[model samples]
Target: MEEAARAGRTLLGKRLLVTGGSRGIGRGIVLAAARAGADVVTCYRTPGEAVASLEQELARTPGKHQVVRADAADPAEVNRLVAECEASLDGLDAVVNNAGSFLPRPYAELEPEEWDATLRGNLTAAHLVTRRTLPLLGAGSSIVNIGSTVAFLGMAGGVHYTAVKSALVGMTRSLARELGPQGIRVNTVSPGRIATEALDEQPAEAAERERRMFSSFTALGRLGTVDDIARTVLFLVSDHAAYITGQNIHVDGCV
Candidate 1:
């Protein structure tokens, strides 16, 4: 507990904002940032028990937290969310673009709506949120874009998801170049197969087979957890990474 407390205070006085933060990997990042003493403002598309539970959890931390509702695909909503966060906190020190949706439809049968939704939520959303929050984020600011390994290694059925994830890395590098002179860092965190609600519905045998496939490819012989990605992000946003920027760090246990 003492060691945990010390870790929680590592980011004292920093302010952060995360998108799609009501649950899953987003929730893990929010909790980690709060525990590290950063005032966190997280956004969700819809509210439910998870949002309330997150509020209670964040309240126990040393820093402050705010939860808002925003659909990343909507530019108006993204602007409002950033405004709300800026109003609640004095300014933004870090922004994590984590809101995304993935539907594995075969390329031969993919619909126009599916393609639009995937790109809007995954790629366009990051651009909108960052542009809106640019004024609030100043020198020493960090922006971490959450991507997937599927972007690097294209998946057979998730063409849309992989495309958007790949685009994000390009976006990060370009933004890093533009923002570097201002002392703001931009990077991408590409995670491997992480067990989440999306994967929980698979048959046990199928799941095991899939797990084994991923484990065989990973040097660590296992899948990643939300906490693993969260901890890596926390490190990137902290002062410890002051000299690091414009890089894509794969957190997939040596994939």
Candidate 2:
């Protein structure tokens, strides 16, 4: 408990904005950023129990943080969210594009709507957030786009999702070069088979079986935790990684 309250200065006095902070890996990044001494402004798509819990957690952590209801995929909402970030933190030091959706559907069953939505969520959302927040960022600013390892290793029934993730890598690389002179860095952090709380709720036998299967997929023979992804992102956004840009850092336990 004492460790939880101890704030580190890795991102001391930095201003950060993260999308999709209500749950899953996004929530991990948000909490980790706050604990690392960043003044964070994170957004969610809707109001729910997740928001309530995140608010309570942030309230207990050091430094001021804001949680807003906004969708990063929507242009209007993205604009509003960035406006709020500027209002809360004055100017941004970093941005994390973590909000996205993935629904597995076989090629034959995949519909046009599903393809469009997945692209909007996984690819376009990152563009919208990054472009809108560019004004607030300056030299030494970092932008980390969350991606997936399946982008490299294709997954059946997820062609649309994989394509969107693939686009993120391209986007990150191009932007890193384009923005390099401005001292703004862009990168992608691709995670593989991370075990989250939802996995714990699975039936004991089934969860164990799934974990075993995914663990074997990696050279390390163990599934990843949210901390694995979060820590890599923390380093990328901090000054410790000042020279790193346009790189895709994978936290997949060597999968």
Q: Pick the candidate with the highest lDDT.
A: 2
lDDT of 1: 0.91
**Local distance difference test values of all predictions, in order:** 0.91, 0.93
Q: Stretches of candidate 2 above 4 Å error? A: 1-7
Residues 31-79, candidate 1: write the lDDT tens digits: 9888888999999988898899999998887667888888987999988
Candidate 1: regions farther than 4 A off = 1-4, 201-206
Q: Model 2: per-residue lDDT, tens digit, 1-255?
A: 656544456787889999999888999999999988899999998898989999999999889899999999999999999999888789999999999997889989999999999999989999999999999999999999999999999999999999999999999999999999999999999999999877988999999999999999899999999999999999999999999999998999998
What are the models' TM-scores?
0.94, 0.96
Candidate 1, residue 178: the lDDT equals 98
